[model samples]
Target: MEHRQSFWENLVVVAIALVLIQTFLDDFAVVAGWAWAPREVLLYAGLALDVFFSVEFLTRLYFSFIRRRTGIYFWHERGWIDLLASLPLVLLSSGPAALALWSGSTIALGRASLLNVLKVVKAIRIARVLRLLRLLKVFARIRNTDSTMAQRHVAKVATLSVTVLIATVMLLGIAFSVFDVPSLETAYQSRITTLLAAVEGDLDRGAPIDAGELAARESSLLAVQREGRTLFSRFDSDYYARQVGPNDYGFAERGDFRLFFDLRPVNRDQSRNNLIYFAIIVVTIGALLFAYSPHFALTVTDPLHVMTRGITEANYSLEVKVPRLYRDDEVFELARAYNEHYLPMKDRRSAASADGFDLSMDDVQGLLDD
Candidate 1:
């Protein structure tokens, strides 16, 4: 039988894909100049997409399950993801708190659950979203598996790896925060209280306050609050010079004292480089692996996303993968070197764009020769 692709199914995939992209790839600054109108509206589109997917997934699942036998074959691999991406939203109105709890737990798992929701996130161009493609591939493989054992094992590994990784990261963050937050919090609270008390006696206190005491009091409070504000909030020089200032939250964004913040290896630029690198790794391995073909349809890589417009490397990718997929030679060498330069090609191409993309001409020529 010819396979029929459902409209809802396509949207199901897109919805999750969008979520992944938005969560991950950031420009480090607001994306101001994109063609999108009233940009915040686009964010609302996400919520709408989520709602549509939820309804579609449920209606399909409900009726399909009633017709058990055919539904087993017709619905096939993605039922679980559809269910997962769908249910949480439905639970929202009925049980908003439950939904919040669910989201919290899922986010705590990091890439694991994110990878699944990301499959539905749509064409979000953000780079971080591409990382979840690896997770989606695993889901696809298990879903396409012919036998119970194959699907079961794939399921097991995906679950085990995701659960373990998320649990580890979550616990570590919690433990570190728990262990380290107190000193900073204590410093913040103590400083603020001291400053507040002194200010209150002079200013916030009842009517007959002395004007001179107000100046001295203000000065003292400014100094104290300045210290508090600088630690957790934005730097305030005058406030620091004075005593009481701001009640601000942290000594430094709450996590500053953690070892991860203290000893984190990647600088901001390097962090961007790592994400670009990770995107390459996940997207490459996810698609290239003939292993994942069954469950989810692999999104073909766009050569355009691989290269910056002026970069010599961008021109090279156009030559290799453009018409014919995969090539070798001087152009091929260039493409290979492109991947080889900083990190593997596997890590670079994470997200897709609607603009038409083509492979390099030389690679196309090589393919025709073969």
Candidate 2:
């Protein structure tokens, strides 16, 4: 049995190492929040990996509880260690970086309170490993090919999951679509300002913005103003009573920051709608679609996003790489006019071929005949 003990010890070591490494990723917060040198995308990537380890730890704990029930189980030293080891992984789950992207403070607080019982996705790559190990270990113990308490527990969890998910989505939809936004003294600034500057550089290098730049900026700024109240006003209840707000939260009735800055919003309605619906629908439909695949045909929305781009853009050969997708002579005139007259657009817009615009193979012969 020393060999059996050896395997679990080794597995625990791996889990412990992963969880410890995951906890340190909050160190990247300094980079993500930087004004000029921010690496938000990479920071988020690290957070995602941390989330994976957190989920793995929780799943193991859930199975452990099911395995230990007898009075002796309570007094078992190894069992005690097995149950308590999951605690460190749990505490690391809520480091600052993970909470930054959380739904408003209200929802975030609620989720934090409930994390003690939470489980991660059952089919993620890590979960598959746990399942495989269990299968191999239990193969000799199968009882006449029927009911186990673990299977029952899984069913109960599934039913509860569906109910909770639907309710959560409903609340977020209302919050996102209908609730009025208040102004916020933001805890974290956005990286969008940096992104917009980069986009402007692309535009300036490509075409004169005197007329065009003013236009895009004007539209984008207006979006910011209109949505400012709706965007920044999230709050915590405890914070409402105190001067700065409690535990860095507030759920104020109204608030905005457009008053303090030379601000503009980008397609505010569309951005908000996408932020709310796209996130929810993509997650909800994705989960439901995968879950129901055993019972029905399902197509995920993100995979179908191609048909959603503008038809004008669809025809603009300059916009996409598909040689046959667009025959836009007009947009070619537009791209060339925009490019040759300017510093020349960099990246995809600059590298796009003018020949592809209207010069089909047939058009070359027609021009020769002419």
Candidate 3:
């Protein structure tokens, strides 16, 4: 039973590692500006992992109750964090599946707003990045089995890594919200109005008969042109041109003007994507460091667990040997030395008892008298 539990725990570790790798790939998709096809692959891969984790969580929960360890399961087992991390992905992944089903219905096919719904589904899918926090909890659990010294060292390093990651994310989020959002929104709005006027041919209105009218018209046209150029410069020239359909004005600028007016959301999405990339790199490195550093500690502590168990059992006249570890480290050497001294002493005592050689002063006096 214990072996089976260990097997599952090891499998869970591997699953978590794969999930983190998928997350990193998703982050790369954002950073490298991957199109929908590649991004969707990563998204589906993440959703599969989320399903696996959800099942693992349920299995553990059921076992916790069956074993009558609800308190330890809830608090010490970190069941809450597991649920938080898995539920979001499950909910987000279901959106697209639900949309696919709805798309085949007559009412859905008739709706012009389905494209907007699809966009919302994509946005929700991106939010699965929040599940990366579960990796930190996994790291904590892995190192918790180490000796006190090892635990202290691992705790310090893990804390530092988490702190740096959180600080980086917070700083980027605050800077983007405070500075970039307002400026980008203002620029976007100004550019939209200019584009709309240009597309309507309002800027081509004839100069007035009066000199003041001619001057004002010329200045206004120049201002509108400048703003148009500024907005155009925000995008790659070729890409902007390609996105501008016959009826559309430029990148993100439509003839209808309704969709073009609300550019703030687009800017916010881009800013969010940037932060997600930053978080992926930062958290991946931290998790890698925290996850692998405990091997050295585990080596020593695993042997110690065996040695302590052997010693405890030896007290009840049961001979026990500390299982020899395969490593040639200090702990291995100590185990060797302990066995070498202990086994010989144990053998001598057993031999003496079998031969009735009791070292008593009364027996020695009787022998001397004889």
Top model number, TM-score: 3
**Which residue runs does candidate 3 get wrong by more than 4 Å?**
1-7, 92-126, 137-149, 152-370
Runs in model 1 deviating more than 4 A are 1-5, 25-39, 68-155, 167-203, 206-370
Q: Give per-residue CA lDDT, model 2, range 1-370, as digits (tens).
A: 9997778656645544443333222222321222212333433444554455445445555555677643344332223323332333233323342454453232121213222111121011111111111111121122221333333333334334433443454455335323322212110112223324444565557742232333344332211212333222223334333322111221111112221111112112222432343334334433433454322211222111222232223233223222233225443344334444432343344367532244566868877898
Better of 1 and 2 by TM-score: 1
Return the top candidate by lDDT: 3
Per-residue lDDT of model 1, residues 209-325, tens digit only: 332443353332211222233222222555332421111111111111100011011123323543554455455444433454332121122333344332434323332243333
TM-score of each: 0.35, 0.22, 0.46
**Descending-TM-score candidate ranking:** 3, 1, 2
Clashing pairs in 3: none
Score candidate 3 by lDDT.
0.51
User: How much lDDT does candidate 2 score?
Assistant: 0.32
Winner on lDDT between 1 and 3 is: 3
TM-score for model 1?
0.35
Q: Going through the candidates in order, what is the number of backbone clashes in each?
A: 49, 16, 0
Distance (Å) between predicted and true CA of 152, model 3?
A: 7.1
